[model samples]
Target chain A: MSDQVTPSPGKRRIGVYVCHCGGNISDYVDVDRVIDAVKDEADVVVARDAMFTCSDVTQEEIAKDIREQGLDGLVVASCSPKLHTTTFRGVARRGGLNPYQYTQANIREQCSWAHTDDREGATGKAISLVRAAVARTRLSEPLEPLVVETTGRAVVVGGGVAGMRAAIGLADMGLGVFLVEREAELGGWVGDLPKMFPNGTDGHELARRLQDEIHRRPAINVFTRAEVVEKTGTYGNYQVTVRAGGEQIRLDVGQVIVATGFASYEPEPGEFGYGAPGVVTLADFTRMLDEAGSPLVYHGRPVKTIAYIYCVGSRNETHPYCSRYCCSAAVHASLLVTAADPGVRQYHLYRDMRTYGRHELEYIESRRRGSVYMKFADDEPPLVTSDDGSLRVTVRDLLTGGDQLAIGPDLVVLVTGMVPRDNAELTTALKLPVGLDGFFNEIHPKLRPVETVVDGVSICGACQGPKTVAESVASGLAAAAQAAAVLKRGVAELDPQVTFVHPEACTGCGQCVGACPYSAISLVERGPAKVASIDAAACKGCGGCVPSCPEDAIDLAGYTDAQIRSMIDSLLVGSET
Target chain B: MTPVPAHAGTGRGPRAPHGGGPRVLVFSTNGISDPGIDLAGSSHMHYPTEVVVISLPCTSGVKPSWILHALERGFDGVFIAADGEECAYLQDCSERSAGIVERAQELMEAHGIDGRRLRMAAICSVCAEPFTRQVRAFAGSLAGLAEVAA
Candidate 1:
């Protein structure tokens, strides 16, 4: 026990603060008992319990104690660090102690909340948790965050509405923007849509206006028919190579925004009489509407009665997620036809009417124009048959309680949902994760919406998920704000909890090179042996390569072997005293 | 100061047998498993407080020696909450962590400890209910083992 209590260089005065959380933790775990249990532990000079430790008054009280007692370290037995780690760290910093010297013991989540019925056990575990924090902080060393300069440039991928908006937003902030589009035209899916909802704005005209604005900006560089060939470097310094017009162009930027738009779902042949004469997809019908005159005509015939099938190639075995735009699109299409020719009959076959938000007005208007809507079940989808040079649709209506409805129309339009673009090549080059539905996954859908797991890159638009045009544009602006915030300060602070290599123990086996997922580790010549060198800017601090080293030569700065061993020992043995 | 225990059947140390009940050490990753555990707590799901959690940067950073050290230090079992596919560290995080657990089990068996004393499970960030159920089941299994030994 004496050997476990290693003497520190300074006066090892420590303070511990436990929060009641207004009986959220107090009712389950005895807070006063915990304070009494750890007050006499090794170097604990001051131990107290608070009603709410995160409150500003309580934080000030903690700061006052730190200054009056001359404390060197602190252990806050409170909620998970995920919520208040930074808040308490700031308390420590204001208390004239290094923020890194503090440790947050998760008593609320792992102890009081997990063991509500066992107060004695929760108190005992809280003591153990605080003891582990004390043990870890006794060996904790003050660390300074790393600061890197920003290049004041950004790379915007996929020049759709989202990408165009992001480029415009970034350029408006006086940052050089490089907008890359894989297609020759910049509008993407929006360029093909005839008009948008709510006010009947032309989609192509909106995209053309954005393109004109982008072309007029001097700081924005537009690259049509271009693709990102390679991306290297870390946050604040990224070298992006783009292949365009049979030439390779390299751009040095600080941040990247991936707004690669979505692809419309294509139905299989004979799935919905798709190969028949007048059967067309919603995209195809919209294109025809854009080209046709007032009276809608298809296949050189005046279209009178039309049948629209919703959720085609979506909400099925192959595609389980709702495309989120199909129901509204179908309703809008029905309204378009009803407005063109009031005498024409329009029938909408859907599993559910999800005409959400203001689009419900269009749904109401479509119904007022004498359009018929029939709901179907998942198991009994609408079946289309082409016989005798005519198309017939059979669907079991769930609304009418298992009644079957039949409709034969001049044209059948399949309301296909949005599918993720084939981002296999881009996903590999960017090293981003794609969800099971094939869309790019964000770190946290609500908290870190546009940000990817990668440090410097972010994702927005339909690439992340099925988004409406307004939602995609909002996501684009949000990503632009995030990027601008990153570069606005002209410097970024990196967490000091990165990997470090000890030259004396390294065998130069080169095993860590393959173990590193971020390719942050490299071998550098040191004396006669080549030791591992980690790029602090590029390292994600995952600590994967730490265990891969056969000689145990590598260790993370904050999570060292000694620190973890001490924590484990403290968890089992309690306090050394 | 007290001498360290030789093995499970050898002798008693400070933590060799305590009235505090069975102690389980949990090694949870900071990214995925730790958050899941927190969610379990935030949801007010109750479990045994005998479990103590230590946050790691990644489960791949766990050393076999550390597992053996916890077992020898008086912990009845060690539960490694791995990150699995959601590991921001590596794509093959589960496979790599399973490799470590395999080696640790071999070391445990060689040292006269039951290989089942150590367990590994993948807990993602949103796996709150699954995590509570897993911990409850694991604790029950350990309790059953203790009864058998008695």
Candidate 2:
């Protein structure tokens, strides 16, 4: 395999390889028929079928053909490009041809698998797809991938459990970390909790342990009362501006991790008699339990009876999502209260119980301790009426077939859910998508859970969605690993298909500059008129600016206007042979 | 399984000297719609083979001249698979591509080509079933138009 190829002007030597995919494609569509149909297509130097073209041995064979057949262009009729596009491109590169000169046709997904019942039609479509690739290949030119330098530092937004854990993970990977916390304290909401569910671990102690770990790391830079005001540049080299302690500081980092934890749902005043005496939120109750020693006392009075109202502001018309962790938290809180005062009786008025995972043990314990649990319908909520320094809570228990149960207790704790933090400023600055639920939306919920659509930026913890402490920590580690992967190579290879400006054709009207989402285009003076110049590193190859350019000056490298037009012509109109 | 359409020939169609099926050109965005098309194939969802795909980086990158050129060169219908908000390239790609399509439709009317022959849809990377359904519907509409023209 050599990297040198001399092509005769106006002539394209193309090789076509059809993969059988081990009968994944062959059983449905006739592979040899496709090869035979496209073999005599104009400029097709060779056509063949393989059991599995993606195999290492077959790739080597294709490379061997590239050298011996003098094929200037190649096409692989196989699986989706998402699967093995880079694989075949590597083969093309080894064959001494420019990787960009190769085109991949989806014969498996778009033809063979799709029209399995119609083999003849599928084969015909495969031939046409290959023909389209060949036509496009004739117009493709060899291009090199753009290599961009990377910074070894990572900027982590929010100093919650996720941020702290991510910072530690990055530091462990030998990368410098800038951990930014909006509040003066490093620990987020986790620092305020009295006791965590399942394991009776002190939330503050857990947060402090993480904070101590971060403090001990030499590579970690802690910034309290800080916020990332602005962020610019691409994946490998990002300039972030942090406003901390009344001064602005700039940091250049390779990646960014968003761990801005969620905000606890705050119930409105008079909501379920929330502002009344003896009526406290679950968060307030947790702090009260922490402050008041072994025997829980509210206002110097020993609390003997307590009623916990579940789903205060969640799973309603206003907030449609279940705060996932609230049910388990409620159970844990009931158990804590039971442990504090063995004589105290607890009644929990709730919706559907969702004590999932290991938290089920705590739920069982709460039930074993004789804490009364009642289910209430969504439409008919429990009514809390205050009369003569005592609370009267009447709920139609769905479990007992609409039997109205009334409980009068000394104290009422509203079990509130987690709400998304108001990250409007940060969201605008980062240009990240916020879902209709007001949480940061990951690119894909399952596949790329921690990764945002933006390159080099990751979202985890409560910011992405409501997550438990353990899940938050796991997401933090995942984000840290993602960031480390970006900086691990010390250099990033951007897509070679980024947009470029034709200086001669550029009118310098600045339309492309405004149209560019990444600010990759800028106007520069050329002779008398200014022509737009593209910063290839900053350009994400979105081609948004291409249509904005009135003079047709801007075009992406791989999907050039001519190449795309040729492909369209090939599909709609046959090749002008 | 539905019977395969008669116009699966290698030659360009509808107006091809050897008349057969309606030739529909599908311009799919590489990042989103192209993968969706692949998923459609992987899912074994069938649409007409007359619909040939031309993968572009984004539908915003498509020039109106290319659509007009395809129409002039014996193509029947053109489908632009625009990536909505999920576009990796630009935030306002849907609106921008819609503007391009609208302009192309106006140009098609001026060129004596039926503006209805041009269709634009926002197909995400995961919308394989929707893509096949859209293509099948578009192909059906084009086939009806071809019968009327004949």
Candidate 3:
């Protein structure tokens, strides 16, 4: 294995340029002092500085140096690589050097910003960062980009609120979409819903309209009772095997979305008599509303008095999170009942009326409408009794000086919360990460709301977390916008900072392939030793495969460890001298 | 009515109000944090004289872009609010938000929009009060600016 692996040798004739950034760095740290310090660094044939290293004029200067001086390697000491690493790399490429030969030093946020009060300390840290980049660049090698042709289509999982909206939005953008729903019908959980609050729009109508629109659009392919069985390939080109209606079908697409909306909360056995006849959940209520048009006329008798129990299988010691949507749902349920039978007395029993957001406004409105709200402490929960023949709920009212109020009515509505699907088979197959609550985790809660850590994959709706119909639709649209934007460009842009595997150095023990969390690296040719090749689009620029390569034949394009560390060394040397 | 605070720097751009009049302050965070406030000129906000522009930063750390946009909207004043500073990496996000609000006020006075109309303030999640107050303040500032123009 050792004999099979050797580092890709670095080429000679290197050029180094330090950017003054128009005194952004020069004013704080002595740019000339740093430049003088690294002028003779090993393998560094020429060194120079400019007022604005990122300017077009400076790029011309670097280009001229590469052509005239025959410089093979390039290093730029300037702002953080995040800002302008691509600019210098482009300059290097324009100057007849492979873009991978260039490296950038981030002396701005990591150093200058931190050490503004202490010039000496800032200079020292800047030098260390630059030297590290220089050391790493010496070990850098040219890497090739793997290009794959896309089928120009996308697969969207789940036919719920999220999936349907994303599908409609994407189809509207002129992209072909295969929207797969796991159930017999589309519209995830929202399909069963009666009415959406605030606007009071019919839920079923929205789903039907969307379904009609999707059906009308030639680009959209809707499949019911479908599931993705196997998935492979990289971003902009994915091979997926889906099982739909007992038929196994394969598809090749450019992108995929998992909008698999969450399942309704199914209380474990004996946890609140969840499955009992009288103990109906929120979803059951939606069904009832759809079927009977009212919770009041249950079994054909007008419900004189009804008690709504909030937070079923939620917010207890077992489940820490307050299923965010329950309060609003409960409030909406109360309004729905009032609309059904105006005379039905609605009593809402709960621990806390956490009617957050616009729901608070609704809560206040509900109160004005004479809906009774009774709060019960967590330890002293309200009691539910169907054993006495009639549905009777007993609760001690905190507002009424400890007096217990017992209401016997025709029915009791249990406002159950949403919970993630229990079976981990599907999530495991995709290698997607789940949150503590088992919902799919987004890349960043704020920054990358619709995007997943895996490129070319986005998630929306309840699959991410509990949200209202409006929120779910908005999220679905956002996800669609992002995915559509990518396809609209007609071509995916590689990071240019990805790693490449040298086949000649192949001791490919398959270690690096396994080390990649993204599953971007794979064994391309399996023989005496498997040949490791990186799918460029799938590789996330995470240097996991670099250190794991036992033979050290693997190297990243832009910011290789050798390149970054050498730059760091150059900065430190400049600091000392 | 008192003017709202300006958060970023003050300025007037090419899109400033025709006849150099006061304009509405439109603060948008690219429909991410403050999706509730529709700058898209939907039926809810059809203020023809009102300017509408989207922003892409946290409701915190609003830049001079807010000030310039408000003046450009051609309303006598401006109002800006959005998501709170929960996960912002920009240090002093609220301060930046406030800085730009102040700068907007300065620009409004210089560009003839009543400075009172250019207001910036913190808006909590799902609460419409801050937004409502800013709208009322913008209207009042527009009235004040109209009186000056008249």
Best by TM-score: 1
Write candidate 1's Cα lDDT for B20-73 as tens digits.
446678899887899999999888887777778999888988888788778877
Question: What fraction of native interface contacts is shared by candidate 2?
Answer: 0.53
DockQ of 3: 0.01
The per-model DockQ list reads 0.49, 0.37, 0.01
The best candidate by lDDT is: 1
Pairs that clash in candidate 2 = A109-B41, A542-B89
What is the C-alpha lDDT profile of model 1 across A261-300, one tens digit per residue? 8999998999789988889998898888888876888878
lDDT of 2 at B142: 78
Question: Against the hidden reference, what TM-scores do the models get?
Answer: 0.90, 0.85, 0.65
Q: What tens-digit string does per-residue lDDT give for candidate 2 at A1-577?
A: 1122233434789988888899988887777767766677778877888889999898998999999989999999898887888898899999999999999988888777887787666666676677778887888888887788899999999998899999999999999999999998988988988878888899999999998998799899999989999998777899999998789899999999999989888999889998888888888888888788868888888888899999999987777888899899889988888887888999999888889988888888888999989999888888888987788889999889999989888899999988899998998888776765778878666667888757778999999878999999999999999889879889977767788989988778899898876767889889989999988777767677887777888888877778876676555433222
Q: Which docking category, incorrect, acceptable, medium or high, applies to candidate 2?
A: acceptable
The segments of candidate 1 whose C-alpha lies over 4 angstroms from its true place after superposition are A1-11, A316-318, A360-371, A574-577, B1-22, B118-121
lDDT of 3 by residue, A1-577 (tens): 0011112234566777777777667665666655655565666666777888888888898898889877778888886554576688889889998887777765553345434555555555555455555665667676545444455788898888788989989998889999988888987777777776765788888888888888899999888888888777777877878888779888888878888877788667544444445667777876777777544566676566767888888887656677788888878877777777778887888888777777788888888877998888778878776664566678988888878989875667788887776537556555565765667867566657878756778888888878778888889898988888778777776555677888988676898876666678888765666799987787766444564565767866654434433332232232455
Backbone clash total for model 3 is 60
Alpha-carbon runs more than 4 Å astray in model 3: A1-109, A112-120, A137-145, A273-277, A293-295, A299-301, A306-309, A314-323, A342-357, A372-412, A422-431, A453-455, A486-490, A502-508, A511-577, B1-150
